[model samples]
Target: MSADGAGGVSRSPVERYTDRMVAALQRLEASDDPNLTFSRLIDVMGRSSHRLLILLFTLLNMLPGPPGFGGTIAWTTFGIALAMIFGWPIRLPALIGDRKLPLSLLIKLSERVAVAARYAARFSRPRLKWLTGAAATIPFGIFVMAISVVMTIPIPFINAIPNVGLCIMSFSMLNRDGVGLLAGLVVCLLGLTVAAAALFGAFELASTAIESIR
Candidate 1:
C-alpha cells in the first residue's frame, strides 16, 4: 500500500512487476519476428532487473515442462551467472548474446512468467533487508556461480530445481525479502546436492562397469 501524492493509489512492488510482465508479454506477442533475438527480447521488456531477465530465461527453459534445450539454456544462464559474479557492469557475450527465440515460445513463456511474477509479488515485502544489499553480493554471486555450474550439466529434470530456486531468489531480491532469498538459496543448495549425488553414483557405476569389462 504505497502512498500516491495525488489521490490515486500507487502500485505495490508486486503489482508493478505484474504490470511489467504483462506488458512485456503483450509486446512479444505482437512482434513480427518469427524468432525474437535475446537483445530484441530485452528491448521488448523495456526495463528490467538482471535477475528478472535471468529468471525469464530459466522459466522459458522449463516452460515446455520437459528436459531439453541443454545447450541454449545452459549458456544463457551461464552468461547471467557471469554477470552476477563480475558485478552488474559486465555485459553478456555478443555472439550467443543475441541468440533468437521463437515468437510462439515467447508467447507461451510470457504467460507462465507473468503468473510467477504475480504469485511472487503477493508475498513480497521488505524483510531481512541485509541479505539483499550490496554487502551480500559476493556471497550471492558464489551461490549463483555454483548453481550455474549445475545448470550447465545437461540434466533436464535435475536442472529444473536450481532454475526454480534461482527464480525464487530473483523474485525475492526484487521484493527485498531476505528470508525468501535465504529459502531460495537453500533450495538451490538442495538441488546441487542432489545433482552431485547423482553424478557421483553415475561415476561409480561407470567405473565398476569398465573394470568388469577389462
Candidate 2:
C-alpha cells in the first residue's frame, strides 16, 4: 500500500506498481521533458538493480483473477516496465522507431541481449544455448503464463498474472541481451502453457459436473 499526495489508503503491491507506471506514462504524455529520453532511460535502467523489481512484477500481476480480466493488462505491463527503464514504453515491433519516441532503447536493449547470450554461450556451451536460456525462463514463465490463462477463466486464485507477465517480459526485452530476454521468454511461454492447460481442464470438469447434475 502507498499514500498518494491525498493520503488515501493505497492499493496492493500490484495496484501500486500499476498506478506508478501509469502515472509516469500520463506525465510523459503531458510533458516536453526531452530529458525523458529513451537512451537516457535505458542507460539509467541498466545502471540500476531492478532485477528484484522485475521478479516481483512478474509474481504479483501475472497470477490470476479480477485484475487479469483484461487482455491488455499483460501488454500494458510490458509497456510500463520498459518505459520505466527507458523513460518510455516500447516493444520489439516498434524497434524501427516511432516519430515521437527514440529507438535507441530498442537498439541498445537488443544489442545487450545478444552480447549476454554470447557470453553465456562460453559457459553453457553453444550446443545447449537455447536450452540453457529457455530452461531459466520455463519455471518462471510457466508460473506467470499459467496465471494469465487461468485469469481468463475468471478464477480468483491469482487474479493479476497478466500484468505480471507483461512487466517481466518488458524488462526481459528491454534488458539488451539475448540471454536474459530468452530466459524471460521461457518464463512467459511456460506460464502461458500452464494457463492454457488449466483452462481446458477446468472447462472439461465444469461440463462434466453440469452433465451429471442434469
Candidate 3:
C-alpha cells in the first residue's frame, strides 16, 4: 500500500509486516537478480518518529510473556504497534486466539523493528536526544502508567513493572546524562520494588483487618 509523506497510513492490525517483508524478499529475487540489498530495504523504511518508534518498541516488549499469549492478540498487537510507530498499515488477516500461530514470524518481525530503529539511530540521534531530553514529561507519564500496572499484581506488584529499566533509561537518554540515566534506572528499579513491597504489605494489613472484624 502507498503511504503519504506525512507518514504512511496505518495498515490494518490484521496484517503482519514480517509476511509482507518476506513476500517482498521473494519478489526481489524472483528473477535471476541479486537478493534485495540492505541499503535498498533501508531506503524503503525511511526516517520515523521517535515517539511512535519508542511506543512500538514498548509494545513489542509486551510479547514473549503473559501479556501476549494468544494468537491474533499477539500478532495483531505486534502489527498494530509497528503500524502506529512506523505509521503504515500491515493488512494481515486476524488469526484470533489461534494457539498454533507462528511466533517465529513475530520474532523475526521484532528483529526487523530493531534493525529499522538502528537505522533511525544513524541520523536521528541528535533529534531523539533533543526530543526525549526536553520532554521529561514523556518519561514521567510512562513511569506513572507503569506504576499503575505494577500496583495491580497480587503482591509486590508495585515493583515488578515491566520496562521499569527501559523507562528509567529513557529519561537518562533524554537528558543526555549517561550517569544520571544509569542512576535513575537503579533508583527507579529499587524504588518500584520497594513501592511494590509496601503495597503488598498494605493489602495484607487490610485483608487481616477485615478478617479480624469478620
Candidate 4:
C-alpha cells in the first residue's frame, strides 16, 4: 500500500493526497492494535488535513454500508464542516471517536477511493487558486455543512446527490482546482434544490392525508 511518488517529483494535490491516503490505509492494515477506533483512524489519516478528511468521509458516504451509516457519516462530516468554519482543530466526540470500525471493510472502501482519486489526479492540477485558497474555506465549509444536512434526511436515494457534489468540492480544494470547485458548486445547488422539493412534497402529502383523516 505504499504509494510510489514517482521518485519524489512534484505532484498535484490529488496525487499527494492519494499517496497519503494509501499509506495511511496500509499502516492501518499492518497495525498491531486489535481495536481501531474512529479517532485513531482520523489520526492515521492526518487530523490536520481537513480537506482530506472531508474528501474521505464524503466518499465513504457514497458507498454502501450498514444501516444508518449514511446519517453517521453525514453528522461526522457536519462536525468537520463546523471545525472548518470556526478554525478549530478537528476532534470527534467520544461516542463516535471511540466507536470501533471494521478494519477489513474500511480497507475495502478505501481501496475504491484511492483508485478514483488516482484517476481524478490525472486531469486535476492547481488552477484558479483563489477559489481553493484560504479565502474560500469558510464559504466552502458552510456549503458543505448545508449539503451534509441534506444528506442526513431519511429520503431514499437523496443522500447520494449532494455527496457527489461534496466529494468534488473536496477534491477541488485538495487539488486547488477552481474550475472544478465551480462545477461542484453547481452540482450541490442542484442537489439542494431536489432535496428541498422532495421535502416540500412530502410535507404537502402528509398535510393532505391529515386533512382527509380529519
Candidate 2 C-alpha lDDT tens digits along 1-214? 2355476853333333333443444444456764434333323334232332343334334333244324333332344344444433333233311212333333343344345433443333223334324344434434444444444455543333344444445344333234545555565556567766777888899999999999
lDDT of each: 0.68, 0.41, 0.42, 0.82
RMSD of 3: 14.2
Between candidates 1 and 3, the TM-score winner = 1
Query: Of the candidates shown, which would achieve the greatest TM-score relative to the real structure?
Result: 4
True-vs-predicted CA distance for residue 61, candidate 4, Å: 0.7
Which lDDT tens digits does candidate 3 get at residues 1-214?
Answer: 2242356753221123333444454444455753332233322223232322233334334355453342223243344334433445433342332233233444466556545544433333232344335355455445534543543444323333434454435434533444545554576677676876687789899999999999
**Clash totals, every prediction:** 0, 33, 10, 0
What is the lDDT ranking, best to worst? 4, 1, 3, 2
Better of 3 and 4 by TM-score: 4
Say which prediction, candidate 3 or candidate 4, comes out ahead on lDDT: 4
TM-scores of all predicted structures? 0.81, 0.36, 0.29, 0.90
Assess candidate 3 and give its lDDT: 0.42
lDDT, model 2, position 128: 30
Deviating ranges (above 4 Å) for candidate 4: 1-10
How high a TM-score does candidate 3 get?
0.29
Worst 10 residues of 4 by lDDT: 1-10
Q: Rank the candidates by TM-score, best first.
A: 4, 1, 2, 3
Question: Which is the better candidate, 2 or 3, if ranked by lDDT?
Answer: 3
Instruction: Write one digit per residue (lDDT tens) for candidate 1, span 85-171.
Output: 666543456675576677676775666666765566567676888998777766766776667667778654777777778878877
